[model samples]
Target: MSRTLFIIDVQNDFTEGGALGVEGGAAVAAGITEYLAEHGEAYDLVVASRDWHHADDDNGGHFATDAAPDFVTTWPKHCMAGTPGAEYHPALDTSRVDVHIRKGQGVPAYSIFEGTDDAGASIGEVLTQHGITDVDVVGIATDYCVRASALDALEHGQHVRVLRDLVAGVAPESSEAALAELGHAGAAIVESGALPTAGAGAPEDGDGEAGTAGDRA
Candidate 1:
């Protein structure tokens, strides 16, 4: 019944003031910090991920190289390694993180499974080594990295949950769609306040239906 927390891409580049800032990104960061402060000990491990792209290369076409950029496939240069954008948000308490993973080094990567730990271990390897059977994911851009990470966790045979209140997204419609997809893929969707004590009360099954937030669009 080991539970692990996956804090995905809470770096400066994805926060409210960064290169790819989301609307509620700053609030999500602060909310996660508050959640951790109250329930830090609930999980066996806390892993934080960052988009540590290279400055020279296009990172497997993840970054736009042409004059016109497609927001879907190509993004403005961001999270370059060793740059301020690659650093974790100042509001994030890194001291609580047990492992640090760097992704999209020189390629396109979204899921935490695509990254390696500080010790050069894959996310799957680390989880297996830790006997992590349950996972809770929270971070920036719910429609992308967070969604990818949660699906990968489920694929790895772990019971997965996404804390809705602790995440922000790039767009309301896409974010709600992503949540529906994750739910359909067997990941539980729950609010942070509704999460039960780890191993004591398990997450309820998701209905695989899209949330109401997308209606604003």
Candidate 2:
């Protein structure tokens, strides 16, 4: 189907017990792993993105420096570069991920499209290089990164499907509203269970450990 799976910010900082931990975030990570175990080959590519903010400064004012975070435009310090909070969640099996995307380097970013690969290719560029016409979106903070990434995918002219069950949001109400917005914007909100078999399948453990960041996309 010339498709790709987008794994949004499923990092420690956004999961339970981190800087900006959300409810059910850890479950989403583990659920994605289980789904991939059975349907990893359902698509041609799998890409994962993480927030890798700079720890030195306020990250272009994304992180509230001296004042309390308002949680809307500004937030508490999180996902610092090279820290554990920036790494993928422990339960997510990143072994199958082919391209590792890191966003929010020194600025505020929500969409995966705003990030670049280690090779400096944007997500859209990578998808075009691979001829990706379809994408399945899943991950943490359904109302934020997941929502933004799905919208950008649509703007990129790719058919987008958001795996609802594989995502966790900052708040239930906001998450529902985000899904509605995505649907209205032309994204298909679907459950992962209803998807057809996919993936070309990659070797286990990748170039890194089974769940380590060495080869995580």
Candidate 3:
């Protein structure tokens, strides 16, 4: 089985100092960096997802704008395309990333798989073309992007695992709910340390840490 790691939305816009920062988002980058440094060579593929949007786009317009009325359900404007906020957090080690998927360019794309290239290839399609079957996911805001990507991977028939320790959330309650939903949808929740060592056997059940983001979910 070809194994792949999908790092989802570990961008500056979602972390501590950005426009729409989530609680614990910075920790996601730190944890993922640690995991990659310790197990960089274990996976055959490494991919990342980034949210790229335009300031005047519909998604961005949903938030308060000097030119538009504020929508109660909308969030703050963030992750403008090509800006520093749209880039992955500086702490995440991107040296091993073989693919980078940019999402939410013109729409409310919550899933990395929803991202398409100029030629219309999806993240899933790219992974399929690359022969990746087993996928592990890590990144920010467990209730949103991370959960959506993991579910989309499972739907694509890939064996999916969520790195419980390497994710954060906009809120604890919603994050917990999302994790339970992912588990019910057949995603394995695992800790970074318990990931299979290269050439070692896969675990019967993906080992997860207590009190982690997914645990609250």
Candidate 4:
């Protein structure tokens, strides 16, 4: 019955004025902060992920070079390692985070499952160690990382819920499509206020399959 709050890629590079800024990305960050502040005690763990891509060379072909980015499979350089853009948005109060996961170090990674913690523990290991069974997904880029993470959570056999109000996306049409996909995949598309019920710990699922979400993210 233990639950985890997954804050996915709410970094500077994804917010307004960032390298890949979404329309309401900043608002999403602020709203997530407010949600955590009001319901911080409901979860057994709070995990936050960031796109910490490598600065040297393209990240496993994630960054487009020598040409314009098509914004589909390849994108402009962003969220490089050790850069301000790689840092979480200021509005997100990371003090609530129990696990810090960093992904896309030298590769294209979309789901938080592709990430590892500061100590190099895989996300599945972290979740299992905490005995989490339910997860609430929230963060930026609804059509990308947030979608990937939620799908992965569901794939891992966990009860997954996406906090629709706490997320932003790269495009409206694609975002709506992603939400529909998640709903079809067994995830509950919920508002931020839908908290996990109070309970003890239990075993959970594992990593997810990267679909078009991974390709774009």
Q: Which prediction has the highest lDDT against the true structure?
A: 2
What order do candidates take by TM-score, descending?
A: 1, 2, 4, 3
lDDT of each: 0.85, 0.85, 0.79, 0.83
Across residues 66-172, which tens digit of lDDT does each residue of candidate 4 receive? 78999987999999999999999998898989999999988999999999999999999998898999998888789889988998998888988777777888987
TM-score of every model?
A: 0.92, 0.90, 0.87, 0.89
Task: After superposing candidate 2 on the true structure, give the runs of residues whose Cα lies further than 4 Å from its correct spot.
Answer: 199-217
lDDT of 3 at 67: 52
lDDT of 1 by residue, 91-177 (tens): 888899999999998999999999998889999999999999989899977988998899999999998888888888889988888
| True-structure RMSD for candidate 4 | 5.5
lDDT of 2 by residue, 101-152 (tens): 9999999999999999999999999999999988889997788999899999
Top candidate when judged by TM-score against the true structure: 1
Deviation in angstroms for 64 in model 3? Answer: 4.8
TM-score of 2: 0.90
Give stretches of model 1 more than 4 Å off.
196-217
**Which window of 10 residues has the lowest lDDT sum in candidate 4?**
208-217
- Prediction-by-prediction clash tally: 0, 8, 2, 2
Model 2 residue 186 CA deviation (Å) reads: 0.5
